[model samples]
Every structure is written in structure tokens, then in C-alpha cells.
Target: MPVSSPQIINMGCRLNLAEGESIRALLAGRDTIVINSCAVTNEAVKQTRQAIRRARREKPDAELVVTGCAAQIDPASFAAMPEVNRVIGNAEKLKSEAWEAYDAVLVQDIMAVRETAPHLAASFSTHARAFVEVQNGCDHRCTFCAIPYGRGNSRSVPAGAVIDRVAALAANHGEVVLTGVDLTSYGPDLPGSPSLGQLVERILHHVPQLRRLRLSSLDGVEIDDRLFALLTQEPRLQPHVHLSLQAGDDMVLKRMKRRHGRAESVALVERLRAARPEIAIGADLIAGFPTEDEAMFANTRALIDDCDIVHAHIFPYSPRAGTPAARMPQVEPAIVKARAARLREAAAARRSRWLQSLIGSAQQVLVERPGDRGHAGNFAEVRVPPSETGEIVTVTIKAVQEGKLIA
Candidate 1:
């Protein structure tokens, strides 16, 4: 099948979608479909292959290109597939020359990459809010993570570039989310090593028109003093914070090579809530980690209530190849699935309670689509009467249905 333009299938974090926007611009008018893959979990890898197969079935004659974490980690695997014509590395995919050539597999040593240049996208296709990648790669080697191999050491985009991108997108998008592999670790590689808080302060100070600013998932240990100050004082910065809290048990956290302990995680949440009572906390929790006993799992369950985490992403541990966690004693698949379900259940209950609390409160929602369902600054999903897409409006919450606030 002949295609008019490159079709990009982005998988994984907001960062990938942000990168996809840049890739879309570079491959404009080209007869190809690029699969920007994620290799965070075994299931993610499976989905990447499934997507490639589906793409091939739909567009049999179109040149198929694969890139991103999954392709970067295992380029040969993607290249070996009959459906994929070429496999580009994560670094290569960003370079204009790599996409321009668009002929053979172009995987490179991602670990050697020392700096990350900002890829500015005019707007986002998936989200009403624009995602500007402020940082790339991870310096900390978590036991279960394979992302460091895919995205090199921690490197930050210059604050000036990020501000410019946010300023550009602000014209079209009301909200801009600062996305990265490790957002809190941003700016350590740059000159004078400015902190993430400093970057955010610069953006808000420079771009007054940008209505809202949000940060993607952050590490509990890395919340700088300036960022904490902003969280309490700045209304423009969204009140929703998603933490990378892998496990709630101290032992499990240690095994995962996390910087913060279970107590530290709880304390951080407490501090954030104290600073801004309206702030909605979200977290990523891993269930059934290797060597995690029932007691350890219980600690994780208790953490949900202790931290008041309304929005939680519970992942049943899927051991990845070459990761330290994979080599450890594995948890039974059934047990893993069960624990994950319980965590989800707890999270649902918390979310329901949170929605119920907002029933009578007035909220400013940025309309994501036509039907009036948009997220508030606190990241609560509010459904209102028919409204224009991308318009921010204040509505009084009236009722709750299926965990969504009705306005």
C-alpha cells in the first residue's frame, strides 16, 4: 500500500509521544510508518511486535521503521523481523540525517551519548496539553530497569531551549508537561548544573501566557527545595504529582535499588500534602517483586492508604532480560497477578473517594476533547456539558459517576 505520510505509533511514556511529534515533522510526506517502541516490560515488548505485525497487515507495501527503547535495546530483533524494514537507535531516530537516509538499520551505542538536544514539537496530537522533554536517560541503575541501556546517562536540555519550546507550544496548548526519563535528575549535566526547580521557575517567569505547567513522574528522593516551594506557592504549576515509588516495603525498595526508603516515601507525601492540601498524589508501584513475601506486599498495600495515592499504576513484575531483578528468585505468575489486582482495587477505592470529595467544589478544567471531559489542575477527570475542545472553563462539580466528577 502506498502511503502519503509517515505514520508514527508511539508507545510508552509521554516522552516518547513528545519525541514522536518531532519524528512526525522530520518524516513528513515520506511513505513509511515508524514504530516508536517501549521496552520497559516484557508485555511492552510483546505489544511492540504485535503493533509491527498489525501495521504490516494493514500496510503491506509501506516501509516499516522501528525505533525507541525496544528497538534501541534489541535492534537486531526488530531488524530480523520480516515486517520491519529498518531499525534505528533511540539516538539515531532524533537526528534528521538518520530519518533522511531511511534505508538500513542504524542502531548505535546509546551509552556513549553524553548530551541530549531538545527536540521541539509545535504541538501534540494525542494530548490537549503539550509535552516538552526536558531531560533524557537515567543515571541510577534500578535492579529491574532496562531503560538506561536504551536511553543513555542523564543529560538535560538547556533551560533556554525548554523555555522556548514551552513558549511556542503555549500559543496552541494551554498546559505543557515537562517530560523525561528522569525529570528530577535534570540539569546535573549542564553548565552550573541548575536544578529542575530552577528550570521550572525560569519557564514560568519567562512565559506568563502558559496557563498550566505539569511535571511527569518524579523520584521522591529528588524533590528539590525550590520545587517544593513552587508546589506550595505556584498555582500555575499543576497540583498533581506522580511519584516513581516502585515498592512500599523498605527491603523491596533496597532490592530495587531505589534511593528512597518506605518511610521516606510516606514522609514525602505527607510533606507535599501539608504544603498543598489540594494536591493529588499518584504513584507507580510494582507488585510481587523477587523475594517479596506476603508481609512485604502488605506494607505496599498499607502504603496506598498511608500516602493517600489516588491515581496509582500497579504493575505485576515482569522480569526483563539482563536486569538484576530477572536473575533473582522469581515470584509465581499467579501471585504476581493477584497482588497487582489488589493494588488496583485499593487505588480505585481511593480514587472514588477523591472524586466524591470534589462533588460540590468548583474546578477549572481544560477540555481535552469535544464531549466536555477534561482534567482539572489536580488531574481529576471532570465531565461537564458540551464544551469546546482545548478550552479551559470553570465548572461546579455536581455529581460523581463511574469515578468521574460530573459538572
Candidate 2:
């Protein structure tokens, strides 16, 4: 990749965005620039094409090398695009390269891990919080996902090394979030010395002045009594959990090849609530899978209502290339969009109810950004009298005002 005025572009989820930050740090202030690509859905792919066209229009002959899961899953398709000069995939771009090429090398040597030498938090995004990738890759075979194809088997960075990274971020007074493809499977490759829970405990014990510790999306299948107990014991850890529940209908769960079913997932939620009633639960819901019809959608809606989730990252089903669901007859685009809209509406209602319930209670709120003369917590954005940034203060929930709780 080569250009007179080069800039990096990233597309996809937080994980991909995190990787893009790492890549930018790898090639910061250089004449050459790297572009992180995405393959989340068909619409996303189209958006990527439009973005590439726009990038070319902005900077013709820019050193635009595309990487990430999108490039990994379908390199030739991306290679065919006119905007892309080079496509690297399958851990090939993990290494430092002076020259550009279309390459896909499946490298899984944790020992050969590409450290940007001085690992730094993403500079582009808001600095209120930072997420560090402690684990990479997946072992589960979800029918609709392209992640396993892009990322190989589970592997974790050494615990001491991870602590060092967290310490670096803490020194800058940034909140640290432990993230991964499947965080539950963290520390599997290494000899069973310390688990993800152990890592958190170590960080909490050592870094006493750390602002906050958060965890990424956790799988329900991995949750047990011990983990829930540990969560109750830790006061510094945020009470938000982003559990990915693809479907609430059992048959749909089978079709999606998800590990946990409706009943078990519900049980897990109940246990969490029992342990910590104030714990804010977050969830992901995918609507309009191949087997999902009106009744199935109703079941999903009811389940969401039952779960009483405060925040939802809802997505419509879209098949990616080389995945099992891609071969199956996809739900019509119109249906997918409609169900997705309904789910969003339901999620909004749930959040409103949760916020209403929080009124007349006190919460230890961390002032992230100065909003329209207010502040927000790990849960809802609460309006406050003028306060300094990074000020962690307690506020009594007064009422739900304009989609935010007033304190």
C-alpha cells in the first residue's frame, strides 16, 4: 500500500474496529495506509463497496489494502473490487510487511503473536473506554457465523502479558474491557494455570486505582454457578453483560446451531438476577432466520419481554458466503427488515420499563462524556448538573426524561 496522503478505514463490529486500531497503530504516520474490511451481512458488503468507491473518489491511487474477516472469508470477491489494491487475509496481515500482496496464511502460533511493540488504545474513537482483546479465534460451529472461518481455534495471550497491557491502559486512566470472539473459552490453549475469572481477580487485586473493568459478549453455555458467584464478589466489575442470544425458539436455536436453548438461557438470566438485582442485562437478538415465521417471531418477542433486557443490539439474519446458513433459503429481505424493526421497538419498550424501574434508586455512575448538559453510566445516559469528565459520582434516579434518566 502506497499513497501521498494515506488514511486507514475500518468497517465491522467492535472486534473488527479494535483490529483496525491495532493495524493503524502498526502503520501510524506512514505514507502507506491499511483499510480494515467487513463481512457482517449482504447489506454490509454493499456498504463496503460504496465505502471503497467513496475512498477511491477521495484519494485515487491510495494504498488501500483490505483486511479483517470480510477479506478473510471472501478474498477473491473483494479482490475483484476496483478500489482494492491488495487483499490480505487469514492472519497474514498480523505480521509487519514492507510490500503489499494478496495473501491468506493461516498462522496460529501464539508464540509468534504480532505485538505492535508498544500496544496502544485506539486513538480515533472516544477515549472514555478501552477494550483489550485477551483472546482470539473460536471453536464453536455456529451455522450462520463466518468468524470461525476467519479466525482459527481458540488462543489466549499469556495472562501476565495481558495484565501488562491493562496496566498500560490504566496508567492513562482509561476503563479496560476484556474482549474476545468467545471470552468464556479464554486461556484454553495454555496449560490450565489461570482462567478468565482468575485474570480478572488478579487485575483487580493488583491495579487498585483502575477506573472500571468490563467484559465483552459472554456465551450462556459457559456460565455456571461458580462464575455467577465470582461476579457477585467483585465490586469494581461493571454489572453489564452482553449475552448473544441468537434465537428464543428452540427449533430456531437448533437451526442456528446455538449451544444454549430457550429454557437454559432463561435460567441463566434468572440466576444472574437472583445474584444481583441491580445488574443491567444486555443481549443480542437476531430476527428472521430461515425457519423463523410469524409464530417464531412472536415467541422471540415474548422471550425478550420475559428476559427484561435493558439494552439490546438487535440484528436481522443475513447469510454470509461459505457458511451453512448461506446455502439454506434465506428469509426474504422484506421479512428480515420488518421483523428487525419490530424487535427494535420491543427492545426500546423494555429499556423504557427498566429505566422507569430504576427511579428512586442510587447508582454509582461514571461520567463518560458530557452529553447535552448530562452524563451516562454503563447502563442508561442520565442527565446531571454540570460535572467534570471522568468523575465517578453517585446519583439518585429521579425519573425517565427524554430517553434518559434524570438524576
Candidate 3:
């Protein structure tokens, strides 16, 4: 019989991606196969099931364990699956003792938990850059969200712990990204209540050797002055911002319980660009939410231009059960899909223009793969001459082909 090393199938956000790396390190040298599932949407749950089945088929003799948000919210459903041998919750997945036990389910009350462990600092992963999770869970109760239930209330890792992790990872990885369920909501739960800005400033000041620092999706409202200043002025930080702007219409935003209005979001981006002309803008927009009329959708569509969103994440509104928005009147499925497509089309056009503008300009590309492929500081993929992997090099943009820059 061939010995099987643990195989981790990860799905979902950057935070989950980072956690998967930690899990992979934890379960090494074992004949177990793990599915690190996501539960952000109904579609995400469906994909988790698909991943589990596929994992089992590929490794029939290995013990199949399921963990992450999907398994945390409904462990019994995953436990009922014939292919699954064990199901662990989000909290238990990190604990060494949880892996030692052979219980059918090791899920605990996530809501009752208060703090998050700095798991990434201890793990070694083979990737172009490292992702360090500074926070986990959410406090906000958005009407269309089930993440809070799955992840529990917002909790932050201490700043000292985070700095230590980054300091260690920065020594090896060329770049490091800060990720969380609610990244901007960091610091409120910790002692002395140091803001995310404070943390970033401290990390930069303490770890001067860190080449590049990137941030995952951000809530536009939470970009305070300290954070905003660093975003505009800091050379070490990447020049890309992905906002969690779900909807562009004020009424739709009100219904979704979002904190920032459309104008506020537009203004924030405007200020960012005014300070730094080269920064790229990315946003997440949902189409055809409950009670959204055509005019409301038009507001959202027009926003793609207003914000100059070069990278867009368009999700056709799918109602998740037990959410407030799910209980309201939903738009037709066809209409939802159509609106989403239009958003993507608009974003692509904006991105094309933005990329074309970069022609003849110099960009620092972080080499990722074996050949000439790498991502720029603004997160644009570029092709350069064959360079050593994990090295950052300056390249002049030559042309755009198939949505990538060639140099």
C-alpha cells in the first residue's frame, strides 16, 4: 500500500486560504485527506460537497475529514455524508488535541469563544507570498450574510503576536497579506484598542526588511485617517485596494445594513486616487438584491464607472436561508444574472483602459512561477523575461493580451 500524505482542499476567502496553509502543516505525514470548506454562499456549500466527494474518490483508503465554516455551521449534515469520517469546527481545526482525538465531530460553540490564535506564524508554506490572518469572525449582522453565524463574533489576535508572525514570514516571503473575516474591525476587541492603522504602522516600523505588504478586501467606511495616510504614502504597501462595496444604491445599502453610503464610497476612492495616481481600485458588487428595481440596478451599474473599478467581483444575488434579505421579496433569477453580467462587462472595460494606461510605465513585478509570470504591486499579472522565482523585478509594460500585461 502506498502511504498518502495529507491533502488539503481549500475553498473561500483569503483568510481561509491562509488557514489552509496552517492546516496543511499541522496534518503532515498522515494518511488523512482534509476538505477546508467555505460557507459564504449557498453555492459555496454546494461546492464543498463536490470537493468532499472528489477527494474521497481520488484517495479511497485515506480518512476524509471535513472542516471550516460550512462544517462549523452544520456539522451533522457533513457527518451524515458517507464519504466523511470526521467533521471539525472552525475553532477546533487549529487545536492540536482536536486532531489527536478520533471523535466523529469536534465542533464547539463558536459564539462562546472570545479570542483567535495566531496560527500562520507557526506554519511554513510553499507559496510566492505568505498570508497572515490578523483577525477572525465578524460583529456586523448584514441582512444577506451568514458569515457571522459561521465564524462567530469579531475577535482579534493581539498586535504583538501579529507583528511577530509577520516579522518571521517577512524574512522568507517577498510579500505578506493581512486577511480576516472583518479585517477593518480589528483592534476593538484587544487591550488598549489599537486600530488596524496602528498595527500596520507598527509592523512597517518594526520590520523594515519586509519588502511588500498587501491588504485583502476592506470596508470603505472603516478606512480611517491613519490607515488612509499609509495607503496613499507608503511605498512598502501594495497599491491596490479591494473594497467590500456590495451595492451602490443608497436604498439598497440601507436594506443591506451597510455602514457607508454610495457617495461616501465614491469620495473615499477619490481621495485615495488624488493622493496616489497609480493605485488600482477593486470592489465586490452584488446584483439584483431583494426589492431591487431596474433603476436601482442602474445605479449600481453606473458606479462601476464612477469609482473606476478596475477589478470587480460580481455576485448575482442568491438568497441564503435565515438571513433578513432572504425573507424579503427577491428579484427574478434571470434578472439577477443579467445585472451581474453587465457589471462584469463594465468592470472589464474599465480594467482594459486602466491597463492600457500603464503601457510604457515601470511596475515592480513579484515573480511567482517558474517562468516569466508574476503579479505587479498593483496586483496586475505581467509576463517578463525568465527571472528567479520569489524575486521582485522592475519591468516596463509593453502591451496587453488576453487581460495580462507583457513586458
Candidate 4:
């Protein structure tokens, strides 16, 4: 019988998606199954458990292993599951030896990991674009976040390693997106304290063949002046800025232990628009948090318009175990769901208007596998004429259909 190749089931953020590709390369030819789990929210953990059981039922004969943030934080619980044969930590998952002859449970103290494993840099996701894990972990202790404990402290992959990886990947892919747990918190842990902007500068400067570069979610407060200049002036960098703006009200932000408030987020968007009008704004907003009154939710709802957010990731408050938000006065579950729906409606309207605005303009879109669809530099989804896959083409927008721009 022909041996089946190993499979990697990814769950969670783009960082995990990127790491999953790396893990795939590592476990090549092995007849095992790996579930890259997430633990950002209570819902995420529950979903991870569901994925474990589902994977087990699909491939009952294969050895099932679990890894990623969920497994890193609580390995014993996953290992005890009847479906799982092995459990590994986030750090160990990247190393080659861990997969050779895995132990029943190999989770370690994540907080003690100071250096990023350099070998996991070059990973492939798609022919059109590639996601690179430039940074990992989080040092911030936001009241609602359990990710810090799961991912450990902030650590950066050195500039040289990252640039080398990008150069190699750029030879094939048209776009490269930098991803991390706390992306904006990059470089502080590195020698000479190279800022994320400096790293971008180096990547763009060195790898001239790279067509486009994009950044994952960022904390607005952490963006330095150098990064600001790049966002406003650099044409190679994609024109979409997705901020980690959790709340819009001052009191709510303070309660959540977030660094920036509503005004700061609005002002940052204003400044970005002033510098580059075509730049699209994206943000992550929690609908209802602990002690969030109707007025506070109103402020958050207004942020959709105030920030001109064209891309929004609206998450309802789901308290995770061991998080400070879980201990705080909780908002009613029904209220949280209602507010989340309102935020989504507001965001959809904003995005619809933004897409409509592009109806008359011409945009350079990078065609993906389907050849008829791709995203512009501003991250606007566009329906284009048939073109070569992985090739960049110019399209004249004629109208807006549903959520995509027709060309």
C-alpha cells in the first residue's frame, strides 16, 4: 500500500496559517496528522477541540498530534483526549526532532523561549502571496487577552534571517505579508532594537524583485515615525493599515487595559488619509466588553464612520478562562451578540461605500489562481478579466457588485 502523506489542519490567525505551511514541509512524507490549534478566545479553544475530534474520525488509523497556542497553553487537556496521540508546545512544533519520534506530551514553559527558531521563516501558502512570521509572542497584558500566556513573551526573528527568507520567497511570490502575534511590537527584543519600519526598509531595499509587501494587524500606538512615513509615502508597501483598535470609548479602553483610546485611533486614521487619501483602514473592534454600557457601545459604533474603516473584524466579547476580563463585571451575552451585529452592519455599509468609490478608477491588481479575481494595493477585492496566475495586471473598475469591484 502507498503511504499517505502527513496533513496539517490549521486553525486561528494568519501566523498559524504561515506556520502550518512550515510544519507541512517539516512533516513531509510522514503518515501523521497535525492540528495547529488556537486559544485566543474561549470559542477558539472550543473550535480547536472540535477540530481534534473531527480529524480523528476522518483518519482514525493515523497518529494525531496537536500543537499551536491552544496546545502550548494547556497540553495535558489535549493529550488526555482519546483522539490525540501526542501534544507539543508552540516552540517545539517548529523543531525537526520533535516530529521524528514524538513523546506523549512535550509542552514546555513558553515564557522561557527568548529566541525565535530561525528555520521556520520560509513558508509557502499560495502562489499569489506568502505569509511570513517575522515576529511572535506578546508582552502586553490586555485585560481581555490570554494570548500572551499562550504565545509567551514578544520575540523577533532577526532582520537578516527575515530578509533572506523574503528574498527567497519573493523570487516566486508576488506579495509577502508580515505576520505575528503582536506585530507592531517587533524589533524591541532584537539587537540594536531595529524597528519594524527599518526591517521593512531593509526587505524592500534588498529584495527589489518583491512586487508588494503588506503588514498584518498593528497596534496604532506602536507605529513609529519611520513606519508612518513608509505607510504614507512608500508605494511598494500595500495601502491597507489594519489597526488593533479594540475599543473607541475612553473608559472602556482603560478598563480593557488598551494603550490607545478613541481619539488616538481616529487621529491616526485622519493623518494617514491626509498623507495618502487612497489608503484603506482596517481594524479589530470588540462589540461589548465588561462594564460596557449602551453609551460606550454607541461610541464604538460611531468609530466605524469616524475611522472610515473599510475592513473591520468585529468580535463579540467572549471571556476566556484566566483572563482578567472574565473576573470583571460581565456584559449580558444577548447584549454582546446584538452589539456585534450592529457593528457588523455598520462595517458592511462602510465597506460597501468604499468599494463603490473605486468604481471609476483604474487599479493594479495581482491575479491569483482563479485569474479572474485579485486584490488591489489598497486591499480592495476586484473581479478582473482572465489573466495569468501570479501576475500583476491593471484593471479599470466599471462597477461594484456585492462586495467586490467589477472591472
Residue-by-residue lDDT tens digits, candidate 2, 313-382: 8889988767888888778989999999999999899888888888998876666666323333355778
What root-mean-square deviation over C-alphas does model 1 reach? 1.5
All candidates' lDDT scores?
0.91, 0.72, 0.90, 0.90
Model 2 alpha-carbon drift over 4 Å, by segment: 1-6, 31-33, 98-126, 369-377, 383-388, 396-402
Each model's TM-score, in the order given? 0.97, 0.87, 0.98, 0.97
When 2 and 4 are scored with TM-score, the better candidate is 4
For 318-394, candidate 4 gives per-residue lDDT tens digits of: 99889889999999999999999999999999999888888889898989977889999999988898998788898
lDDT of 3 at 78: 100
What is the lDDT, from 0 to 100, of the residue 405 in candidate 2? Answer: 86
Which residue pairs in model 4 clash with each other? Answer: none
What would the C-alpha RMSD of candidate 4 be, to one decimal place?
1.3
Task: Using lDDT as the measure, name the better of candidate 2 and candidate 3.
Answer: 3
lDDT of 3 by residue, 1-407 (tens): 77557888888888887888788778878888889898888889999999999988988889999999999989999999999999999998987788999899999999998988646645545677889999999999999998887899999989888889999988778899999998999998888998899999999999999999999999988999999999999999999999999998999999999998999988999999999988899999999899999899999999999998998989888888789999999999999888999889988999999989999999999888775899999999999999987899999999999999999
